[model samples]
Target chain A: MRHDDLCHEVVSNLPTHGDCFVARDATRNDSGAIMDDENKKQINERYEKHLEKGERFWPDTIFRDLIMSLGIFTLLILLATFVGIPAEPKADPSDTSYIPRPEWYFLFLFKFLALYGQLPVIGKIEWLATVLVPSVALGVLTLIPFIERSPRRHYSKRVLPISIMTIMVVGIVLLTLMSEVPTVSEDGSTLLGTLQTVVGIFIPLTAYVLLFVFKNNTRLMLWTTGLAAVSMIFISGTVLTLAPEKKTEETEVATTLVDQIFAGQDLYSVHCTECHGDDGSIAVIEGVEGLEGEKITPIHSRDVLYTITDSAMLEVIAYGRPNAGMPPFGKTYGGELSRSEMDYIVVFMRYMWDDRFEVPQEALKPLFPPLAEGEVPSYNVHILPIVKRYCISCHRPGKDNNNYLMTTYEEILTTGDNAANNIIAGDENSYFLQVIQEQPIMNPENPEEELIGVMPPTRPLKPNVVDAFLRWIMNGMPRTAAETGALSTTPTPEVTPTP
Target chain B: MWKNIYLWLDERIGFNDLNKNLLDRPEPKTTWWNTLGSASLFLFVLQGLTGIFLTVYYTPSPDHAYDSVQYIMEGVAFGWLIRGIHHWGATLMVILVFIHMLRVFYTASFKYPRELTWLIGIGLFLTTLGMGFTGYLLPWNQKAFWATTVGTQIAGTAPYIGEFILKALRGGPDLSALTLQRFFSAHIWMIPAALAGLIGVHLFLIIKHGESHFPTKDD
Candidate 1:
């Protein structure tokens, strides 16, 4: 039960210096002594008076910690159960639209990227933020213990460090929160918006600088600077809140084709501009020449854009001319562009190159059928051509349209989205009819009415073409112009029942 | 029965001596702030356990890695919980180890005989960061992919050996299957082995030079 009896066997075995440091009153005890209960009691008293506070690691500290770790483990289990980790869409290297964001802890560094990206000189050398600054920060962090050897544990004594730490924590937290916030406005034209952000950053930074300068007036500096910091934050918050909010995602407005074409242009500039040039006229791609050693065709050239039909161009865009060194741009083809996005690119190319494809403002109205009274629209002349032109682009083989290929009548009639046939002759309830009319395309089995978008994606068929198709189906879709009269006598089995 | 077993083991191996040595050590007078080191160690153990569990199902290839993680999350029983603990435990370990370092620095406990300990602690810190960085890309998601790209690009910015380091890290100019394998090896095998050895030295140092006493008004 004596100190030396209990501890000496291990203490003696320990490296020589261990016993020396272990003896709290190193000077009081000799190099080697079998301390009795009386000496042990005095050592304990001295320990009590000299040391601040501590508990034994095993029973007291470790036990409570084991319980705390159990609690943390339980919390982690709960977090796992409720807040499930995200396993995002599989890593598709071809998908250019993906916004790569780091984990939340790294958001502060991510925000530093946004800051460094805007600055003139630092922006050029991205490693300044990405590598050098962060490396420097980490190096400083590692070296702090070696540098600051002052034996002061109390917070009150370390004003500079505590303040710097406070500022750092606050700064990192604020920056992380601001990581998603845009410096530029929606259109990306306004310098003032970015200027406001820079001013917002500098305000608190200036306050801190002033606070450091006036550290002598400690209490007054804390108050006035704290107030200034708060007020500046409030002012910046107001400015940022009131400033035109940055458009995070492009709003899909169901308006005219002009805007759709404009959106397509924007997307083209993002995805294709590097290879195809700004005007889509670059024969030799600047960066890609070394990659594949092929010269790209000028997409904006009159012979290329004007000669090729829209559907053919869509096919080229979707499937890509891999032999010609162009990669596929369609999602179905393991590329990024959706069916609608490909359509947009087509529209943009057509508008830019072929003046015949240009839409005048006056002709923007829906091209509905100006049907002559009692003159039935022909299937071959009217409906077939329209389907061939517009619907078959995506609905054909290799494209994703639920296998409802418009090429064959049987495929169209039989294949719908696992729910209903696409086009039942003489039935208004047909899926094809529903979709073309801009009506809600529903799934019959689900209790909650699920709605798929209108077919042919972004742009609907001309109203006249939709009407022609409608009349053809409603009049018991004929094989030709002559077979239209046969509808009166032929009882359409397709229209009789849903089952 | 357990006592008999303990005595049997203790008679042969002297297990009780080691246990007594560890448990009956003279602790420095300290508050809750001193517990960060223990907390960090606990989290490291937690990470090691969870990381081992993950490796059972985890595929190191670029193609299978993401799918394997998805399968672990969705198919395997309590895999999400294990993976989550590992992931969160990593962040927590980094934070706790950092706070422990800060405490040492603030108290100037890294001075005197403890300078080597502090230096070893810095190595441990770097090792812990290496674990985090290398482990991050195993998910093979966009965030992980691009973040690793940026992270390795930082190494690529070093003047003379930048290109070589970048190539060595990535196995080529771009991140590929080789890169994934390299990172996986570093995360699970290389860094952890280094950490274990460093930790051995660190604990020895802690025992050699007993934990620094809380500073009193006089000293």
Candidate 2:
């Protein structure tokens, strides 16, 4: 009479084969109830009946069950291999402008709130959508067995509950789909900031109303509700898709050279406009009272523009004009602007004040010397300025350059990181040139030498700049203009002017 | 050698008797729908396996959590595979469990003496969802943070104690380090333990009462 006895009795009444050896001894189940064989014969009859229609759970059910599980496991492996996972940028809490959205699975609830969040009255009681509605639906879902006690299982006999389930499934799917779609306009307006109640609530309510009106005709009710829901989603999606997107700030960063100059102008205003007036021509820098006595020239003046070439301008900007109170701005010189950003400021100055001097497609040659016809480049005029602008920041004395220094002619000629007297003039195998060219030398004595990486180390210097170094070295390292003319007949290649 | 080991264990464990009771039991004719329960169990086991591997590299703190997750994806060997399985497995488990319940409902498997099983199954369903909601916040990314913030706020809507519930669930009003800590523990420990216990009960009830069959023309 115990529950286990009833279970065994129930099992026994099912059909089984003639060799169906039954375990008839009273045994306690996990629940500690003794199962007896008082109705063993009757249970065997029930077993015989069910066995005619069923099989053992072991090989029959479990075998297929395991195979299905393996299929699911294989699916997980495929998704893991092919689809992969996503990890976005690290979280920055100070960035309040970031739009916070939930995972895709919870998009249904998100979309639900989005729908009801804007209405005049119901929006005030936002929890009705967030909490009350979902709870009621879940409560109904859990209470279904107690509510529906129909003895039949065929689809036709269970029309009411099945229909309700169909409608609920359709609703959740539609809402989830709606949530996934980009509903918020570019201006952060949801459905034009007005029709939220009509779209979010009334449409769903109307479908339910139709469902009640056609309750007796379950098929019609489902059809009407399903069609209505789908159409609502379709229409909303179509309208939202067709609207014009508002221009975000990112779109304003143009890609053309003119646009880059414009962008540079913006950057120049933030940094340089503080010292130089809005136009770069303010001769007496106004803001800083510290540099009031220094004779500062207008950078945009014809005299300055024609006198100081781009390379000299870059040098002044990179290493600060400390005596004149100008702070360094290049990242290399303990400042903020990158190499490319410094290029932008240079381009901006040219575009603003000296547009008549055409900016070359690339940086002009010997940006310091402004090479003349047949004028062999000098080390001080060309190489020294290039080194001061590019290398001196890291390579100068008292800095971390592996003992290399480029401040003066003697220092430039002496110290090196990998070898001594790195700059052997007229020797192409010089360690200096090799490092600049990113071709490191293996120690001939020690074959296990760890070939050091390139010099000006973070990135290779510009090709033209390296070529100038090559030309300078090949010309036997002319130090002075008179030394350059002395090396002029040293079989230097034809120095043609760049048209 | 195998036979000796089997015999040694069988003598103490009564393997034959256990097999007869658990495996050789008769059941209603199996159909495709019956496979859902097994599928749910399979995914849960998969999730547990992958979750263990992820925990090896995952830092629960807000500071290193995102970086650690990125390191797993980019740096660790087969870490992506493990995390991906865990991620997709959570979703598939929820879906399969829901379908299994639906199958039980449509067939009226909750009828008669099976009501307790159905009720336990509902508890299992809720536990699966709880596992999902808690697991989501552990990644500690933007989506995880905001989603959990909104998700927990729903629990905050309970009439009188809503404010208290919300604050307690979040470990504070705003999502913070403790929120990640709390959700990590719940996902890895609390809900999984509840799910395992409820699943045990659910299977016990199913075995106690024989499997319910589909209604036939005669019935």
Candidate 3:
């Protein structure tokens, strides 16, 4: 419609609140139009009829707009404050194990491509789903104005477009919901995959075709759309139910500087402490099999700290200095640590030893809560942290610890060559207790040889740590704080009577 | 003094004309759904504000991008709040823009004299998604990195110009510092410029044609 007609429509609509300038301004703004006069006249009259009952935009429409905008602002703040963005580790291109998921809105397209790939013969054409399908969909969406050109605005007159869009939207939503369900299961079962394909592709495609065929019959088109939508949802629901439980991969992402520093400290203690010593002050590596007595720069020294950039340090850790005794500690070089772990190690080094970076006080908390006299230490509270810091480096898998792995409480109790005698509850003679106490278990078979050498051969455990272990094992090893609390004999620190 | 100041400003700025054309018009009795367009505009402004704040601390290079964001979260006052809003606003804007389009579609608002408006709306929608795609890589974190890698790779699967598209998107074969820089530029400057321009046109069209009225069966 012409600009004058729009103004006339607005002026004619608001009889209660008339604007005198509208008509004059509308006429002034009037210009040539491409639309034929007859069609424009009809549209203008229809809009004018609607406007006769319409409200003024100033107080009525603008009020709602303001309220909605305010509501949205409030929701945004709530979401920002409560469900904050989750922290992810720094990108590591070499860490191919990291699963790449697109933003949630694109998950439907991602799922559609996955399902389309399951079709026989044509499934191998990667571009069909990735490029062509999306492009075609976008093209169709963009041309919607011209495609269904009938000016019939009522739903009954517009059955075909509405139904098609409904089915399309439902399909997109269902596909996104089923994105996490694998097209093919690990055991090669394609049942869930078939169900998803039917929901995601077959039903929607068939419905669109059927809707076009019955375009003149409004009732039939609606039925087809409704049936198609229901069945698709039903099938997707089944697929979701039958879908295997996803394994939650817990990647530790330290967001705060203090957390990163502590994470770095723990990693360093486990991996670097053997060669670099606890404080990274070891000038010569000791106790490591072939690298024993190997001369190396003290890692904590200003020479190393000031000279090596973080990236360079990362490289040195990832691809170890071959001429020196340092073994690769990054996963890319066949080591145990991921890129994030290695980054944490660097952050830890800078904060703790580098004079330039001040360490956060929270990061310097004791490895475990100090034990009271006669109180028992649980594996959860005391042993786990201790084992992680002192034992797991060599005792973990692939290390020369006689198959002993202290990574878990169960592993500590059940693993190792001498599992039966590893941590015998209530027995101070347990191999673990004896070893940590600097008493190596003598090989009974060859009375002259020591079987399990003194634990953490590079350094001895502090007296307090050894004493905690002695009390813990002697009182029967507890797994939880509750269990340890029951075993405590500290007499509850006699509550004094208050007047 | 206030009346004189108001008179001077009104005479210069044409406040009466703005009110007559823009605000003091008639709209068909609107429902809550009618507010979606304005809500989307609000979100765009919010996202723009938060995004600007983010750029103050967010480095676009691979080397310092992650560290800079971490420092923002840990060191800067209310930095987390700002980044958080930007992050979530992007998501909300995409959803609102999409639903706004759907509402327009369902009401057949794209028909007749408002066809140009519909076309501009489509442009706005696509640019909104473009903004999302580019802004996602600024964090330089693992999810952003790998997702962009796969996202660009998907773009690269086109029949003939696949390699060109991929290289153009990434600025190279891989998602390196260059890709981060490119994405950052597009996120902050290029796509946003397109979005703002399209939105201007969209608003103008809406004002020119007036909001579409709810349909009724009348011959």
* TM-score for each candidate, following the candidate numbering: 0.59, 0.60, 0.91
Docking quality band of candidate 2, CAPRI definitions:
acceptable
Off by over 4 Å in 1: A1-53, A121-127, A189-499, B1-8, B12-16, B26-32, B99-117, B205-219
Task: Show pairs that collide, candidate 1.
Answer: A53-B30, A367-A464, A368-A464, A369-A464
Model 3, DockQ value? 0.71
Interface RMSD of 3: 1.2
- Write one digit per residue (lDDT tens) for candidate 3, span A1-499: 4755666677567542113232332353422122345646777898988888999899999999999999888887898799998888888888867889887888898888888888998999999999888898899999987787655567766778899899999998998898899989999999998899898889989999999898667678889999999999899888888889999888889988888898998899789877887788888765678887899998999999999999999999999988897888887888778888999999999998999998778888898999877889999999888887777777777777789888887898899899998888899788998888888889999979999888768678899989988998898889999998878888886888999
Over B17-105, each residue of candidate 2 has an lDDT whose tens digit, in order, gives 99988999888787888999989988888898899889999999986787688778767888888888998898888889988988888
Q: For all candidates in order, state the fraction of native interface contacts they contain.
A: 0.35, 0.55, 0.79
Each model's lDDT comes to 0.67, 0.70, 0.85
Rate residue A17 of model 1 by lDDT.
Answer: 27
Quality of candidate 1's docking, in CAPRI categories?
Answer: acceptable
- Tens digit per residue, CA lDDT, model 3, B1-219: 999999999999999899999889988888999998999899899988988887888888888998898888778999988888888888988999999999999988888889999999999999999999988888888889888888898899999999999999999998888998989888888988898999899999998888999876431
Candidate that beats the other on TM-score, 1 or 3, i.e. the better one: 3
- DockQ metric for all predictions: 0.25, 0.33, 0.71
**Residues A1-499, model 1: lDDT tens digits:** 3554655566566543223233533454532233345454554454455434565656765665576567667766676677756544445454556676665667777766776677777588866766787787778766665555443333433444555555555556566655666666667764644544454355556766766786554454556456654654564466556556556564343134576566566567556654665567667644232433357678888889768888798789888888777788887688767655666777777776676776656434332345654445665656655555456545666655565666765665566564365667789987778878877566567746745556544445566677777877787776666776554444445665656
Task: Give the winner by TM-score.
Answer: 3
Give model 1's TM-score versus the native structure. Answer: 0.59
Q: Which stretches in model 3 have alpha-carbon errors above 4 Å?
A: A1-36, A372-376, A420-430, A437-448, A478-499
lDDT of 1 at A403: 58
Q: In what order do the candidates fall by TM-score, top score first? A: 3, 2, 1
